[model samples]
Every structure is written in structure tokens, then in C-alpha cells.
Target chain A: MGREIKLALVYRDMWQSSGKYLPRVDQLVRVAEPIVEMGCFARVETNGGGFEQINLLFGENPNVSVRKWTQAFNDAGIQTQMLERGLNALRMSPVPADVRKMMFKLKKIQGTDISRSFDGLNNPVNLANSFKFAKEGGMIAQGALSITYSPVRSIIMSIWRINILN
Target chain B: MAGIGRPVSIGKMVKGIRERHPDIIIQYHGHSTPGFSVASSLEAARNGADIIDVGMEPLSWGTGHADLLTIHEMLRDAGFSVPDINTKAYMHVRSLTQEFVDDFLGYYINPKNRYMNSLLIGPGLPGGMMGSLMADLENNVKSVNKWLVKRDKEPITQEQLLLQLFDEVKHAWPKLGYPPLVTPFSQYVKNVSLMNAIQLIKGKERWSMIDENTWGMILGRSGQLPGELGEEIMNLAKAQEREFFTGTPQDLYPNQLDEFRQKMKDKGWDVGQDEEELFEYAMHPQQYEDYKSGKAKERFLEDLEKRKAAQQGLTSVAMPQTSNSESNVMPQSMTIDVNGEKFKVQVAYGDAVEEAKAEASKEEPKPTSSGELEEITAPLEGKFYLTKDSSEIGIKVGDKISEGDTIAYIESMKVINAVAADKSGEVVEIVARHGDDIEEDDVILLLK
Candidate 1:
């Protein structure tokens, strides 16, 4: 119970959950040192998921952003993480296994130390593949379970349940 | 998990996961929506969760993850050895984030996403998707209201439409096999529900307008559904003759890393610092292409400027010109207005050429006859074009035209509005030539 709890500040998710755009690479660069100095976070989520797509929307090279931003954190003795959508691999549709593996390699080379990967449907097959690729590509793969609430036998569920019960 | 779980349920889940595999580390990621995430975080930590994902304020709470400062204090109070936060550094990061929100991104965020909506608990939509969902809901509501107004019916409010959509999602989720309401799948369910609501509003049947992507999700293209597809969708799929996939989703998307690498080679693009650029292209082909071409940034900045101007209550900038010499070589004088103050400015292209000025004077409009000729003045200030972009033929001398006829087109603000004739007449002479920048009340055509 006395163990030091590691806190990873989800910077990418904070903006994405609140607004439509991510801050420019220059803006992120300015704040990266201040974030490391905050002294509570063990890790900072640099980019992934919609991060690259949002950077493209701003007409900036996401590769450059990830490299410089993660380097800033790594230099400050803080680890960096990226959100990965398991089989989808940073996009909505399914990605080829070869490209998915290369994503982990590229992200790791860009200075990201961890990859927090999740399958939206909680498919174990997808998660297993993500962990294998991420670890093989030199990243600490943090498998995620997407949780949701489901009421027991509500009006809609009752109909399906009744058909089975009968 | 996505932070939507109750505290007790989260505790049980974390404990259960730890019990099953004691060596595996558990990190809890919960959202602050529906007011349960703070308690959920505490419960998870107590139940052997190794780490907690927290968001820094002023970007915390609302639909984002729980606040770092609050969670750290709470965890420390609960006897956990949480790390100390530098107050000054925290304050600086908070202000920097606020500055970003105020700068431009604030315009696109729905204020509703910043508050815990208890109403969302029933539909169980994830907090991360709530921001974009509300944005799409706002847009969809506007379109629906506009349609209703056109039909002379009572318009619905965003709140009303959102409630309807939630209801439809509740219905559709069960029908679509209750896939975990997460990214991609949650969006798929929300979109189909939104379409159903819109169709019913327009007096059309549900499932009348299903998109291919939604069909793909329903037919097992993403993966095997946990539950069964509803009878209606199944019947509709059968009627539409849509094929259902029984194979693994990844098998359908074979290895294409080499294909993308070859594409980057053909385009002569650098593979970047360890092929990161190529990875971006392989991931999102269209968006990466737009970014490489510089079109994305141009449009993004343009939209930001427009939104900023609108927020500042400024209309499109207009210059009040006093006069402009017809000759290109002459000094043109105009009035520049800044904050309601006017300053006279004169700009000269170059030293005046005598022969060039004479030629410009000669090109000026002349009377074809000494008789009374009617002047067809421009109704608005714009670039006067003798024909639309699609046409080449124009009104010429001696051409007969009828009243209410479109004699020429005037392009203003990218819209080509037809300039109609006031009375039927024969064109005696053309005054405003093609592509001429004519002002209001300027004679564009001479009629007889």
C-alpha cells in the first residue's frame, strides 16, 4: 500500500476529449519541459490514436512532432506513451499485421517508450497481436480493456431473453 | 477501462483481474463523466491496480480523465505513496493549457462536454466520444430543424433530438449485438441511431438509409459480434443481399507494409527518422497526402481565421476607395480605414508610360451613335463577366435581349449571380468588358 503510484498524464487525450484539434508542435514543445517539471507524472502520453491525423490537419509532420516532443520528455527523465487501437492500429478500419508491427517499431524509434493498446470490442485476439508486435518492436505494451455499462434484462434485452427463456 | 464503471464494479473487476494473474500489472483509466470516476479510481487503486491515468487541468474533468491534483491528494490521503507535485509547475501547465483552449480550440468544443451529464449514464456512451458526439449532434439538429421549418412543422431543439438519438441508440445497440460502446463501434452505433432518428423525422422508415460502413459492422467485417443482429437488420440485410464474413478480420487486410514502402519510394518521399513518415502514409492515406500537399494546413488556418473574425464581430474586410486611375501606370489614390480613422494612401505601379496611358484612354467605352442610349448599370459591385465560367458566348453589339433575361454574370464572393436585364432592348455597345472589376451603378452595357 506504500508503493509509489505511477501517474501518466494523458495530454493527447485531454485535448482530444475536450476539443477538435491538438496544440501545434511548437506549443507542445514549449510546454513539454513544464510538464516534466510538474514532478508527479512518471510518464506523459505523447501521441498516437488520432494524434497523427490531427497533426496532418494542421499541416505539420506528425513524425517530427512525435520525435521532438517525446525526446523532450525522455531527456527530462520521463517516459512517453502512445495510444494504439489494437487491430485497427490508429485508424477506424482493420490494419494489416505487417503495417501494425511497423507502427510499433516506428513509434518506439521516435522516442515513445510505451504503447497503451486496446481493442474496442474487447477481442483477445486483437489484444494479443498488439502486445506481441509492441514488445517485439521494443515498447512496453500496456494492454487495455474497454469497459462499458450494460443494464441487466432491460426492455430491449428482455425481448431477446424471453425468446431464449421460452 | 473507459472510466464508465461504478466504483464497486470497478473494484470487483480490478480485483478479479489481479486474482486471475497476480503478475500482470493493472492500470485504471476512468472518465469523470456521470460523476463516478473519482470513486472508481480510489476503488481500483485499493483493489491492487498499479497505476491510474489522470489528466492535468484545465483539460481535466468533463469528458476527459480524472484530475491529477485531486486524485494524487486523495490517493495520498488513502495511505498510498503518491509523488509530490510542484505547485508552481502545475500552475504554469494549467495556464498554458487554458491559453490553448482560449486561442482557437475552444470554438470547436461543445460546452456540454465539460459538464457531467447524468443523462449519458443510460446510453453509456464513453466520455472520450461525447465531445465529438455532441458536436455532430449540434450539426445534425440544425439540419433537422431546418428541414422541419421548410415543411412548416414545429422545429425540435438539440436537447430533444439528443434524447431521441439516445433512445434510438438504446434500441439499436441491442439489435447490433451490443458491441462494447467504444471507439469505432460506439461511433458506428451512434451514427446508425442518428440516421434512424433523422429518417423517422423526415417521415421515412427506420433503416431506410444505411451506409456501407454500418452494414460492414453489422455483417461481421470488424469481428464476431457478442450478440445477435436484430430481426429487422437481418431481414434488411437479406433483402439487400449483403454478404456476412465468417473469417478473421485481419485475414481480409493482408500485409501491405511493402506496398506502402514502394509507394513512398515511387513518390520520392523521405522515409523520415526511421520510416515514421511512411507509417503515417500507410495509416491514413488521404489525410497524409493532404498534409504532404499543404492543403490541410491552408484550409485549417483559413477556417480558424474566419471563426476568429466572426467571434470578434468583424465582417469581411472592405476597403473604402476614393478613386482609382484607369491607367495601370498612374498613381491610384484610396482611403484606408483603421479603427474608424481614415488615412489617404497613394500607390503607384511605376513611372507613367505615355503610349500605354494613351492606349488605355483609347480603349474606354465610346458611343456607337449620338442618339439616346440606355445605360445598363451594374446592380452590385463585383467582377463583371460577359459569360459564366461554363460559357464562352456573350452579349455583343446588335444582340436582342428580353426583359428578365440574364445578360451577364457578376461574380462576388465566389458566387456567380446572373445580372438580368430590366427591359427588352438591342445591345448597342459593350461598356464593361469580360473580367472587368466594375462597381455599383457603373454602366456595364449600353442598350437601345
Candidate 2:
């Protein structure tokens, strides 16, 4: 409980941020207490405007498995359907037709990985939005954001100087 | 002697039951009657009934029982608890034909559509008004919570506070005599006013005091729903219309109201007008009242028993073997003065509508307050069905049937939900259009 190693996590708003609408975020947030109390920190790495890919920077537990996090969120209906394109990376399924249609009209800037439901309260974005951002085909821009997810400790610690792409 | 014997006119079987068991607790079961009739459950309290029952039909579990508002009032008035468990499985069966109400009412009238009756007929736990309100609010919140779960959206400020406010208002309304039917419609309207405020929050639409709740729905009907409720109806209806009243949700709910509406709307015709009226009709006072607390129903039973004994003695002494003819009986019986004028009509009590009708035509007599009078009414809608022979030993032309049988039933929603004799007695005169709505409460048929 002391000054836990701090990690800065980032994600986009799936619904409405300031004055625009995006897509409905159906994926929920699951918590693995091993590292962070909430769960692994998932962020969308965008290329230019449209989404490119999503990276799950681990929390306190650097070796916390991807299968474990995805399965955990899936059971809670946070991360519905996902296509695992990598060990630390994942591209989620597209939004449902009904939801996508509504969000399409409602979204002002056509966003990627922005959680609009209550799940976003825990983190900045929900699991569903993260998957959707990658599902729409966003790529991992130059260097990957570095972070260490600790499942047991339940605290996500950021790592620097190790940009994989760079 | 008062004209009393009539089918569907059981003056307090509740009283009958309570007298048999003084310490017994009365229980209300699930019913199809609309909200106002459910409020009539207040009679249970007046007569000393106990415990009321209900289920979550549609809008939301534990929140959408058609009679929820009135049921809550009945609970408040009697100071009893509302039911918590559904004990019986219930689904809101809706219609979607061009005539919305026609389909809805038609389905309700059908015995087959009723899937939520006669379960858990035995004794169960008792509850109070707070529990009822709590169950309603908690269950509704749960449903809303489920819908709001995945949104990653910001929590609308003060949702908990707003819900608390709504619960308080709902609790207090019953003290005002169960809200007079039109009130919930009005209250919903007011709440929707706040619903518009949800728009001010992030991720919600911006609504004004003026865009008419979101367009493409009826509003501001003079007598139908209060104008105050117009906005709320607009607000909620806009959403529900998309979900249930007009949309195609068959893939999700095949036998639901949404599916029905989808089927009917496919015709590209409009029958929404009558559908609304049918909604009103379903809310009529039901066959029985909710059992109240204490012992009013007990005392009421004592009074009814005494009244029955006194009337019984008088009848036996005067006209023991009364003929089934209009002219064979006395003509001086005074019935209750409904509203203003003394409605002098003979009384006939019977289980069968036909037997009562026959006795009404035969031995029934004119009600002159001399224990000999009856109210007259049409037998059916088609052609006035009457006895061909004038010399029949039953009721004469001038006699009336104050209570024993059904006067007539104009068939509409398939079968006969007849307008039976309020009181069976003699026939006086019938006043009604060949094709007109049955005006029973007004006594459009003035029996002499």
C-alpha cells in the first residue's frame, strides 16, 4: 500500500468524449488482483487517424498471461469476442450492426477504443472499445508503449527505453 | 324487498370468507384487470382483507405490472405489504394489428393468452407498502443497471439521488387516494421532464422544453392523457416506441408486444387510435378487491350477513312462490339511488344469465317501492329479442329486471363479456342506440 510504482495508462473514449459520439462499448473491464486491482491496462496505438492496433501493457506482473486476462474479461462480458493476433497484442471483433449503426450516426469524429459505459470508470476505456479500435484495423504506430502488468500485485508499472518498434 | 339476486353480483364473498375464519389472512393473487380496478383493492382494507399479489409483466420486472400504481395504493391504504416474489410466471402479451387496442384487448380477453394464473394458491408470507416500493425500485434499478453496464460511459450525476426522489414520490402518492388513474400518466410525464435533463449529461441527447419529446408520436389529447404527462409520454414513448410499440424485436422476443406491433405495422396502416382506448378499458375495476388489514372486511361481512337475513325473512313472508312473470310480483321496491334519482327496479339473483333473463321477462314486476319493481334493458344488440306471446306468465312489458340476469351483450372482441344486471328485478324501459357503447353506469336504459 506504500507509494506503489506508478504507471500512466492511456486509451480513447468510445462513446462521447467532449462533444462527439463514437461506438457503443460492450466489452467490460475484468480485474486480476495479482498485479493491478482492476486489471491489465489496454491502450489503442493509432496510426494517423483511424485505429491501427491495440497493446495490452502488463500491470505489476510483467509475465501475467494474455489468455488469463482475456478469459477473465470474457466471462464478465467485458471482452465479448476477440481474435488474438499476438501474445501482448489483440484485435477485437467488430461492433454489432445495430450498435455500430447507432454509434456511427451518433459519433462525431468516428473514434477508436473509447469506453462509453460505466466500465470506463475503472480505467480510461473498456475492453470492448479497445477490441473494436483494433478490429477496425488500427496498427501499432512506430514504437510500442512499454508497461509491466503485475497480476498478483495488481498494479500496472510503466517501462521506458524499451520501445520494441523503435 | 330490494332486488338483489344477480350473477357477477356477489356482495362480498370476501365477507363470507372472513366470517368463516376470523383470524385468517386474506391474500390477493395475480390478475389481468388494469390499474384502476387493482386500486379497487382498497375495498379489501375497508372490509378487513390482507396481503396483495402482483408480478412484473413487461416494462421491467417488478415495475411493469399493469395495476402496479393502484396495487401500491391499495397496499398503502390498508397498511399491508406488496408481494415480492412472482410465484407465477407472467409475460406481457401485446397485440399489433392495425387496431392496436383491438389486438391487445383481444389477446387479453382470450383464455389461452392467460399463462399466469392459479399458481401458489396456498398461504404465503405477508408484506407491506415499503417492501412493495422497494421491490419495484430495486428491480427497476437493477434492470437499468444491466443496460448501463457495458457503456464505459460516465455515470450520470445524481442517478441514485434521482431514484430516491422517485421512490419517495411514489410512496406519498397513495395518501392522495391512489392517484386518480390519470395521475401516473401525469407523473410519468413529469419524470420524463427530468428524463430530458439526462440529455444534459454526457453521452445523452440534448432535449429542450419544446422539441415535443422527440417527434413522431401523439400528444396533448384533451381528455386522454393529461397534457402535463404529454412530455413524459413523449420522452419515454420515443424510446419504447422504438423498442416495443413499433420495432421488430421478434428475433429477441418472438411472442412479445414488440413482435406483434412489428407484424401489424407491416400492413402500413394506422390503428393506433383504438389501441390507446383499449388500454383504458383493460384498467376496469376487477371482479374482486385486494384484502386489507385489521378487521373492516370482518365487520363488513357481519353487516352483510345481517342484511341478508333481514331481507330473506321479508321475501319468504311476502312472495314465497313468486311466478317467473313480470306481472305476478309486487311493484313497490326501491333500489339504491345511483347518483341522484331513485332507480326503482326489481331484483333477481341467479347464477345463469339466461335463467335470470327468462325470470326477468316473466314474473318480474314494476318497482313502485312496494316491493314490486324491476329495471328493463335490451336483451341483445342484433334485434330486440323478446317473448312473442304477451300472455306469458313472466314479466309484463312495463316491468323491470333490477338484478337477476344479463340484459344484453353486444359482441365485439369475439366472446361475450356481457353487461350483466347490476340488480335483478323487473323491466321498466330500455334507452340505448341500436349500435352504441353500453352505458351501464349511466343507466342509459331507464327501467320504469
Candidate 3:
């Protein structure tokens, strides 16, 4: 028999995809609760990755929305995940190391089971601190390899391996 | 990065990583910038990537992430073990998601965004910027058409302008040291490139419309560039000459937890242990404050509804007329009704004399004994921010400031240019207040 693979579904892109399809926070909460309860996903990539920006853009309190979503996932007995941009965390720009640490700590506390961290440049050096912080904060640190093609792919491959091992 | 669209290369890369670190969990995040992310993702998985990032089919392709359905099917077809995702449930969710995508097509889709560009491989515009660049191109073309019409020249189509902009972006990338085209940085590159393209289209000299943010990036204020910036580019940037930050950019900004807390307190917001709200306020003060004050939320919802109505091909219901001009009036306080709620706003025009006198009275008296006071002028024309936060003790009258100390910041073209003191001396007076628009070489502060 083939090995059973766990499939994690990332709906964070839906926030962007929905574009004008933006439902109110309450509406999203109502619709997502049943879907999350279906219990099919190994992990639901539900929050973070511009959730704050969308909330802000739509005039919803991000904290409230995040809290509600996380709680819903928790109630459904499903682990929730988010993509963290290494040192950048939630903000567009690179935040202070202290701020990045705090963000991980807070997310963990708020019930973020896993943080799939990646740097845009695929720089392992940048991912190191975020990985450390995520582990320290008691969350699973899923290191992301930003897949890009290059003639000298060996250099990045080595870096990616080294980053994960370290 | 260059092999983004090449799946075989990605498979090789992933295989190499897998071979090196057998125990490490690998997730693949691919963008459909060059319209090859789905294939690339499957390649990554076939080689050894454990987790592949994929979006719903409705939001997939053309600069979006890889489609989940495609990834699942390809992985299964390759004889790889797959997850037991309920196909029926997944499709149900997708159907709902498609409804949302359909509603938002007007806001998200544009002519430029609808097509795949092979040229994107050279400039490497991030997936996130696709929609925005399309919107920017649309706006730019409209302006260009207007200009052409005024000049009695043939109006160029949006496609032509988009191609020109793409060409300019490719040219600008090397000049800007090829900073990773991501959020914040992507916007910076796009702005500089767009400005350059527009200026070129108008037959203006190169670097004639250099945005301050681009200037700052060129000076290494934003972050380190990937390559050596050319001497000519640096010389052109010197025209808007300002002190460039040599050290790490984050060093210039002090922690503002206490200041934000205080602001929250002053605003009568429920100051609690929520770091999330604090972080939101820290990153976007004005927006957060507006949200907290119950103004921005109302406006956003109203705007969103209007857009939604327009998207549905339904006529937008007329909103109650509120005087936009009254909102702009300064010193004159006015009560305006928005959605039946009245908000009293008092707008103070530039440097109210009474407020200035009151502030001067609060400060310590200036010393009489001094040499001739020298004026430190602004290096460029921009809005001067006195301090990053209210808690920050900026240079005031009778305060000793050192040479190269950042007394204020002049924000122009979305970049904050730190205003440093040329010579160390006691601040005799602060000529420019917070949010004051000062001209080039205007006196910002007086030093004795």
C-alpha cells in the first residue's frame, strides 16, 4: 500500500481571491465554522498572510477577526496554520527582531499551531530567527522553500537543506 | 529565482534539498508569474517537497498561486501518495469561493492582469503586484490619453503603455540593484519604474521625476541592494541630496510600545494587553486611529457596499450628501452626519498662532547668552514629521542636539527622509511643526 499523505488546505489565498467577494467578518465566521467542522483537512491554512490588511481595508478589527477564526478552528478540533514572512512577520516591511519574536509568541498564544515561514529571497539566514522564535513559542516551525528555477540551483538547495537542519 | 517557470530545474532543486536533509519538512511556495507554477509545484512534490502551496481554482493562475485541484490531480497521477481530501466538500467550498471571485472580478481583474507575460521572467514582478500594476497601468494610460488629447496627438492604448512600463521596469530593476520584488520593496520599484516610464513617455529627461522613496532606496536607506548601483544613477540621485542612512535602517526607529499605549489611552480606546491592536496601531497609526475613532470603518463599509453594488451591475443607492469641502475646512469645527451618526471635527490650519503661543509657554525659557543663531534648513520639499511618536522627546527650544542627530523627518513620495542637524548646538527654535509642508531650503530649526 502507498503511504498515506496528510493534505493541508490553505484558504488564506481566498481572502485575496475573493477580492470583491469579501464577506463580512460575521458572515465569514458563520460560513467557515461548518466548513472547518467537516474535519477533512490535516491543517487549515486559515489565518494570517494579509488577514490584518484585509480586515483593515474592510474596516473590521483584525484582532477580533483573528481571535474568532482561531477559536472556531479550535472548536472544530482542527489545527490552524498561517504563513509568516520570516522577519517581516505580519507587516510589509521587516520589523525589529523583538517585534518578530513577539508576533510569533502572540500567534502561538492565540492558537496558531504552525507558522510556515519563508523569506522572499529564500535566504535561510533570515528564516533562522523566525524558526527559533516559533519553536520557542511552542508552535511547529514549517520551513518553506520558495521554489524558483536557477542554473546554479545547487547553491540554494544546499542553503535550503542547511536552513532546515540548523 | 530565474528558473521559476522551469519545473525540471525546480524538481532538481527540491531533490537536492531532500537528499541533503532527509528529515526536514519542505513546503513549496510557488507563484504563477510566468504561468508555470502548477507544473513547478508538481515537480517540487515529485522530487520531495512535502507541502505545496496552492490556492482555489477560481483564484488560481495569471499571477495567483497554483490551483489546488491541478496539484492534487498531478500528484496522484505521478503515483505519489495523496491526502484523503473529500472531493465533494472541496468542490463545494470552491463553488462558494467562485461566487466571491465572480463578484470581485471588477475590482481584481484588469486587461493587463488577464494576460500572461513572458517578459515577467526578466523583471520578475511578484505575483502580489500583478493586480496593482494593472490598476496603475490603467490609471497611467488614462492620464496619458488625456495628455495626448490636449496636445492633439493620437491617444495610445493601455496595452502599449503597459508594455512601455514593463520595459521601464526591466530597465529600472538593474538600476535599483534588483531588490527582491516583494511587498513594500515591490511598490518602491514599481513607483520608480512607473515614474521613469511616464517621464520618458512625456519626453522628459531621465531622473526628472525621481520619487523620494526611490531616492532613499538608491541611497541604501530601505535595505541593501543585490548589486552595485551604477555611478550615473547615484549622481542623478544626488540632485535630491539628503543624508543617507549608513547603518541598519531599523536602528533609526525606536520602540514605540509606550507611546502607542499612551496614544490609545488619550484616545479613550480600551487599552488592554492585546499586542495585536498595538502592533496594528504601530504599523498604521492614522488608519488604526481612524478605525478606533469609528470613522474609517464606516467609510470603508460604505465604499465597499458601493463597489459591491456596482460590481453586481446594480445601481448604487444614493448616500446622504455630506459636504466633502466642509471636511477639508481648517480651524472651523463642523458636525457631519455619516450613516445617521454625527462626528464633530475641528480642523486647525497651519500653525495656529494661539496654539503656538500656548506651546511656547509650556517650554522652558530660552537662554539670553548665545552666539549668532544659525538656521538649519530643510534639504528638500516635503511634509516634516517632528517625531515618530508623541513620547519621543524631540529637539525643542533650549535642547542640546548633536551633529547628525535626526531632529525630524521629511516625508516625500512615500519615503521618510531623516533630517539631521549639520552642526551641534542648542536648539533655539523649531521652525517647522509636525505635519507642516516646508519648501526646499526652508528653515526647519534654529541652532545657537
Candidate 4:
């Protein structure tokens, strides 16, 4: 029982329109920025395209671990698409009590309508790799990719594997 | 435990004490016996516990292992490091402290300690946990013959085995939390005996079922087995009480029958049918059938199913219910019916209650044709929640939400996601409600 790491995801909702994907750019920033600054995790898009939007955040060792994040939400009556991620990654194992109670608090700000299971989010690893290598980067492994921080040396594991673009 | 059926937990007590006395650094140590445990003691250490109480056994999470030596060995298999164990604590103490040994004997005989009460476990012996488990396994796994015939499904995964145990232990005593009491743990071992007992030792010629040597450690080295266990199980069967194992006497393997008898006797049962009668029953196929009508088996199963169904802290009465016919035991609003079974629907607990209130206060998003602008409010306090709003595909007005759908999100930082119906017909009017900062029992979306 090292210090229990509690990850709270504040994500952006995407609207589907005219047989195409529409990203809620404003809500993404609104929900995620404050959440990230608050020392929790949130998603951020580099540019356009709903396809690339999923890569905003995750860790390196494992997936976002919705099990840890969602039980608190579920137990507290907060809704989550955490279950959907069951197919994408191993759901987070059950956390202990005090941390469970704390994660339950952080989830308060992140709770919203779950659009789908596992959130069908993208890997930020590919986004960074694509930016680093341009068009050469392609066909990323969905689960292996993640949103990694360079200075803090943190990487939010991707729910899906990814082969970095390039 | 100082006394049987008293339900003691060193883990919870240690946690409570530590929270109050974070600095009470007592020189802590621990040891597990064959039937004794370090789980409770180790749990204490993890949560500010200092000393480890050494008794007799080793460590295996799911069901538990043979004796103390076996448990420690299994800990190595599970990737846990046991660097600090004092394997010879009792041996060293025995050599050096004659006075301490005298105190221990005095303590064992004091009668005030109630230590002797723990030695009376057996068939139909009221709270004979092993007996209870046998009855449970038989009850839950209906068609024992069919199950045995087809028992080779996926082997129970280590994680699954652990989680199942956690659920059962948690169920038996709600407040016990993660590291539950030994009573429930013992039952778990007994229930999964076939799965757990057959320890696969990697390079061994074959996985071995628990034999006499192991059984000695499981019950207690000093406790009766070949004599006592045999007597207890036989007497329990004779008494027509709930029994987990049943089969043709001819089907019984040589060591199995003896092992079973010893286990029964260890709990103080009487194998009165006699060795000759047992051997006679063991060899004759037709005579065994004459005694096997199984009306008792059916009754045992019915009682067990009832217990499992009502794991939620309340004594359950066996009554079949469907969604249509309602329970009149409680008022309609106060109780909720899930498929005819009734549960008292109380207000949401902890952060959920606060989040529910916050949902009621949230601001409503701009109204659209399919998406309703009516505010979804929190019925109680809870952390605001979201159902994995993956790339937001907005909800439509015609979509109907069952009772627990994600209608809106709320959080006083511990948010609760209020699941409301998407379509209660048309969103007739908009409330500045979609994300309005709401409070207790506030109105969310009016489903008009």
C-alpha cells in the first residue's frame, strides 16, 4: 500500500451532427483546465478533429483505470462510462476506504453524462508523436499510447494500445 | 477471538486505535498458526499497526493454506516478500521464558479467556463455520452431480478467487471492510476446498489435494482429526442436518473417506456407523442407493439459497416476487422493488447525497430539438457524476431514461450523476436548470 494514486478524469463531451463528429471545444477547456490545475487529470485537444480528441490524457504503466475512478462515482450515485472501458483496458482494481472517499470527492467536478463505455478516447502519445514526426506517424496502437508530462515525468496510460505516428 | 461467535476483529480495533494514537509505536510483531491468521494482524500493521502477532500459519489471500509454514511458502508464490518474519519466535521463547510459558498455560486454562469455547467447532454445533460452508456450497451449486460431472470450467483465477472471498467476507459482516474476520475466511476456505485444496506446486508430478498432514495444520496440530473429524461429520449426517458433501459410498476414494471423517471428528462429530458398517457401505453399490432418496438434500439447498440471496444484512424470508406484484411491507415511495424483491430505498449516502443537491443547482444548457433544456436536479446530496460522456453525443428528447439513467451531473466536489429519463415526452419548457448550482431535494428536470 504505497500512497494510493487517485486519478480523476474530467473529459469533454462530443456531439454527433450531419453524419460527422462535432467536438464541444469550449466545455473541454472549461471542465478540464480547472480540474488539471486542481491537481487532478483532464483532457485537452491540440487542434481539430474528433478522432484525435481522445488522446488528451492517460498514464504509462496502465490504462486510465476507470474502476478506481468510477466506483466512487457509482457508490456516490455519480454516473460513469467507466464500465465501457472494461473492453478497452482492465478496469481499475478496488481502492481502499479513505482514498475511495477522497476520489469520490474529486469525481464531483468530473461527473457528467457518460457518452459511451471506455469513453472511446484517443491516445495522447500518438498526438505528441504525430506532432513530432508529421505525416510519417500512422496506425498507433490504441492501448499503448498515453498523455505523458515531460517535466513532472507523468504519463496517463492509454485505454487502448497505440503505435506512435511515424 | 477470545470467545466463539463473539465476532472479534483485531484489524478494525488496530485501525481505530492508530487513528487516535498515530504515535503509539508499540514494538509490534506477528505469527500465524495453521488455523490462526496474520491477515487481521497484517492489516493492522498496514494501517499504522506496529507489532505483528505471531501464531501459526502462512499467507494465502483467497482461502488460506495448510499450516503456518505452508502459508509463508505460498506468500513467496504470490510475489510477496516476507523478510521480517520471526519463524522461531515460539521456539526461542519456549527455551528462554519458563515464566512466560507458565503464564501462557495459565492463560489457556484460565476459563475467563473463553479460549476453550473456540475448540468446540463441529457439525450442527451452532456456528460450526465449516459445516455452514459445506451447506452453502451444496445449496448454491445446484445439481451437484451435474456440476461435478462438468466441474472443469475455467479454473477460478487468483484475482477472482480473492474477490469472491472479499465479497463473501464483506457480506457476512458489513463493517468488516477489506480484511474480514477469520470466521468468514474459514468458511471461504471450506467452500472452495476442492479448488483451493488442490495446490499446484509448479513442477510437482501432479497437483495434490489436501492430505492428512496438511489437514492437521488446517484444523490445528493439537486438535482431533482422524478420531474427532470422523465422528463429527458422521454424526451430522446421521442427524440429517445440512451437509455439503454427498455421494455413493463406493465413489469415495480411500484417503478421502478417512480425511472427511477426521475433519468431521476434529469439530467433535461422532462417526457412530462404525468402521465395519462404513466399509460395508463403501463397497456395496445397491445398499448405498437404498439409503439415498435425497429429500434432505432438497431442504438443505432451499435454506442455503435463502441465505445467499439475503447477503445484505437482513434476515431473509424465502418469498418469490415479480416486478408486477408490489411488496406491501413498506410504503411505495420509501421502498423500491427490483424484480419483485424489495429493498428499502433510502436517501443516497455520503458524497452522493451532496452531489444530488448540486445537480439541482446546475445551469441548463441551450435548448435544442432533441436535447431538453429542463434542469436535471439532485434529489439528495451526492458527488456529481458522468456516464463516460465519450466525445459528447448529445441526448435526444424522445429517449426514455429508466430510473437510474444519467440525466445530469452534480458535485459539491464529490459529484453524483443523477440518472433521469431523456424523453418524458417533449421538453415542454426550459428551466435555467442544466448545471444550476442546486441543493438538497431540489427539483431537477420536470418530466412533463
Best by TM-score: 1
**Candidate with the larger DockQ of 1 and 3:** 1
Question: What's the DockQ of model 3?
Answer: 0.31
CAPRI grade of model 1: acceptable
Better by DockQ, candidate 4 or 3: 3
lDDT of each: 0.76, 0.27, 0.63, 0.28
Fnat (0 to 1) per candidate:
0.76, 0.00, 0.24, 0.00
Over B1-448, each residue of candidate 1 has an lDDT whose tens digit, in order, gives: 5566779877877776666568877788877877788899899899888888899788788988889989998999999998889999989999988888888888777777787777778888787888778766654554455445545666666777889988998888888888888887888788778778878877878875454456767888777777788999899999978899977777778987788788889889987767778888888775687688887788788878987886574223343442433344433555667799977866433221322333334444545434767878765555677876322588889999998778987753213557888778899888897755565446788888
Clash pairs, candidate 3, are A149-B3, A149-B4, B331-B347
**True-structure lDDT of candidate 3:** 0.63
TM-score for each prediction? 0.75, 0.17, 0.72, 0.18
**By summed lDDT, which 10 consecutive residues of candidate 1 chain B come out lowest?**
B348-357
DockQ of 1: 0.43
Q: How well is each residue in A103-128 modelled by candidate 2, as lDDT tens digits?
A: 21212122222222211011112223
Tens digit per residue, CA lDDT, model 4, A21-132: 1122332332232222332211111111122112211001001222223333344433342211111111111112222222222222233222221111132321332222
Sorted by TM-score (best first), the order is 1, 3, 4, 2
Q: Which stretches of candidate 1 lie over 4 Å from their true place?
A: A151-166, B314-448
lDDT of 4 by residue, B1-448 (tens): 2111111244444455556546543222211111333454334444554332122211111111112344334444544444333435533322322332232212211111111122222211112222223223322222222222233332232223333433433232211111112221233223323222222211222212222222222233211111123343344334544333322211122233454345445646443322322221222211222223332234334543653454433324333343422333433334556679877644321112223234323434433335444444443332333332222343444554554355555432111233454444443433324423344334444444
Index of the highest-lDDT prediction: 1
> What tens-digit string does per-residue lDDT give for candidate 1 at A46-133?
8997898888867888888888888889888898989888888887777898889999988888899999988876666677888899
C-alpha RMSD for every candidate: 15.4, 31.8, 11.9, 30.6
- What is every candidate's C-alpha DockQ against the true complex, given to 2 decimals? 0.43, 0.01, 0.31, 0.01
- For model 3, residues B283-329, the per-residue Cα lDDT tens digits are 56644755766765776667557767654542232324545334353
* Better structure of 3 and 4 per lDDT: 3
Question: Where is model 4 more than 4 Å wrong at Cα?
Answer: A1-166, B1-377, B382-404, B412-415, B429-436
Model 4 residue B247 CA deviation in Å: 30
